[model samples]
Target: MSEQRETRQRYNEEFKRQTVKYIQEQTKTVTEIGEELNIPAKTLHSWLAKYRQFEDEPIINTEKVWEQERIIKEQNQQIDDLKEELAILKKAVHIFSNSKK
Candidate 1:
């Protein structure tokens, strides 16, 4: 039997930016805006933080890239070790086969 599938939705950054502008223009409190928009106040606050773009204004600091460079390096080291082990195993197999001659 085929099960029903659900689709999730997300708003683009520009949409959030415009919403912030609308909120500012209406001078709406966060709670009221949240209720009217059917969005959590905290989510609106996050949009306010990241999407604020104005001339001579500080850039938004909302989205920080969370790269795990250290984890990548560790994984590379593991791959190198596995390659070395495979090479050693191949050499051992070669030597034992020649010894039977």
Candidate 2:
């Protein structure tokens, strides 16, 4: 019987930092990026944790990510409000036009 051992791949600090930055960009989900880069989600999460732990590192700003999420939420709420207003106006117009006929 033959026994085989698996070898682990090592990544440098620079590569890890860049990967963390890429994740912060919010272009795609972690799962999608992991599949594309052939990296495990757990590894990517570990890199993110380390990146966030050191505040002095300027490679990626976690604040920016949170701010972007806030802005998106506000914009979506505004869109919903506008859509509701539009529907109400349309109904009012329909009712008024029918009364004249």
Candidate 3:
């Protein structure tokens, strides 16, 4: 019989930070974010606790939040424009198909 050795998964600091930030900003429980991200809930909780110990600061910076919101707004506008274009194309296709028939 061969003995099997299991290697532990290692997460970088940035990943840990982002996971904690998601938990703080998304209004989702730590367990929910952990499950969604495929990370163990206990591990995430420990990471968050460690982060809090190091710095009592908020997870996301105010400027970063504003920038993220602006980017999301711009992306949403682009999506709306694309949807309108798609609708116009659908209308044109319908008109052309009827004319052919």
Best by TM-score: 2
What lDDT is obtained when candidate 1 is compared to the true structure? 0.78
- TM-score, candidate number 3: 0.45
Question: Which segments of candidate 3 are over 4 A away from where they belong?
Answer: 1-7, 53-101
Q: Superposing all C-alpha atoms, what RMSD in Å does each candidate have to the true structure?
A: 16.8, 9.7, 11.3
> lDDT values of the candidates?
0.78, 0.84, 0.81
Residues 21-66, model 3: lDDT tens digits = 6676767888888889888899988988866443434557899899
Q: How well does candidate 1 match the true structure, expressed as C-alpha RMSD?
A: 16.8
Q: What is the TM-score of each candidate against the true structure?
A: 0.43, 0.46, 0.45
Error of 3 at 79 (Å): 37
User: Which lDDT tens digits does candidate 2 get at residues 1-101?
Assistant: 13323456689999998888878776788888999899999999999988744443445568988888999999999999999999999999999999999
Off by over 4 Å in 1: 1-9, 54-101
- Any residue pairs clashing in model 3, and if so which? none
Error of 3 at 76 (Å): 33
- Ranking according to lDDT, highest score first: 2, 3, 1
Clashing residue pairs in candidate 2 are: none
Model 3 lDDT-worst window of ten: 1-10
Better of 1 and 2 by TM-score: 2
Clash totals for all candidate models: 0, 0, 0
| Model 2 TM-score (2 dp) | 0.46
